[model samples]
Target: MLSGVSHTLRGLLDDLQAAANLRPGQMVVVGASSSEVQGQRIGTATSLAVGEAIVDTVLAWATELGLTVAFQCCEHLNRALVVSRSTAVARNLEEVSAVPVPGAGGAVAATAYFRLEDACLVRAVQADAGIDIGDTFIGMHLKPVVVPVRGRTRELGAAHVTMARTRPPLIGGARAVYDVETARQRLQGV
Candidate 1:
């Protein structure tokens, strides 16, 4: 089961990266419900082992991509995220107290808290990308210009998967120049 989950996640993330053009040092937020992975209702049948598998898989993948990953806790923890201390400091996220447990933070977050090199909880983050397993609702952590990424492999175990990546929001009206060359030409005309 662990191997299967890891493999599925790897494929999904690969597709996301390909479509999103994610770069190094960017962060990805993951929200997972082990109960959903097991075909159970959310918060009904948490599985620590499944959570461990997910955290391990995601961390390994992120390492290979030179990206950061954060695991979001359940609503019980106010949806706070589990991230590395370095990430928290670098992103200027406010540190919060409280260690995640299976009962409160859910299995995935608890596993990430223990697995991360220097795990800490943060109130919020504007992640570059997101992967939601079991309908965990990871939208809150993503940047404003969220774009959904669809891949061939949809489900992870019994859970539904949703992925997204963000881009800088497009501002200004139709007349606003979006390219450097266009802007330069317009300025010269002026």
Candidate 2:
């Protein structure tokens, strides 16, 4: 049975995946504050149950989408991320030495660390997309050219949720043509 928070998060993640057109193996960074989810000040209260719901829900969606998920620790850990060993190896991310505890690393990250197989901490990552629950600020983990995704489900429990996807940086200036059709039309002087 899914908790209310889990159910809401599932819908939000589904909407984000569809809107962003996320592909298999793409990475999604998640930063959550279980305290905020329970309507408490961030870091003031940590709920293991809320954290479990978040980690479980996100992992289930990641499995279904064939995506890689990273959980961001709180600033107490310098915002390090918990990822699978495979993800660290595949992405060539430097491994950090530290175990996440609920009080320091944030509940969601701590839960993820235990839940993920061969879990390891990485110093940093540039993921394809990100989910920020309770304004935990996942922006730093996302790739360049971040675009906000407004999903149908706005809040997870009492926490405000924000989602984002990244696109490749647009290099050329105004004279640059984006599509073949546009290039053709410009060449024809139409």
Q: Local distance difference test, per candidate?
A: 0.93, 0.92
Q: Which stretches of candidate 2 lie over 4 Å from their true place?
A: 179-190
* Per-residue C-alpha lDDT of model 1 across residues 34-110, encoded as one tens digit per residue: 99988998899999999998998888889999999989999999999999999999999999999999989999999
Error of 2 at 83 (Å): 0.3
Kindly report which residue pairs in candidate 2 clash with one another.
none
Superpose all Cα atoms of candidate 2 onto the true structure and report the RMSD in Å to 1 decimal.
Answer: 2.0
Q: Model 1, poorest ten-residue lDDT window?
A: 169-178
Clashing pairs in 1: none
**Candidate 2: worst-modelled 10 consecutive residues by lDDT:** 1-10
After TM-score superposition, the amount by which residue 105's alpha carbon in candidate 2 deviates from its true location, in angstroms, is 0.4
lDDT of the structure predicted as candidate 1: 0.93
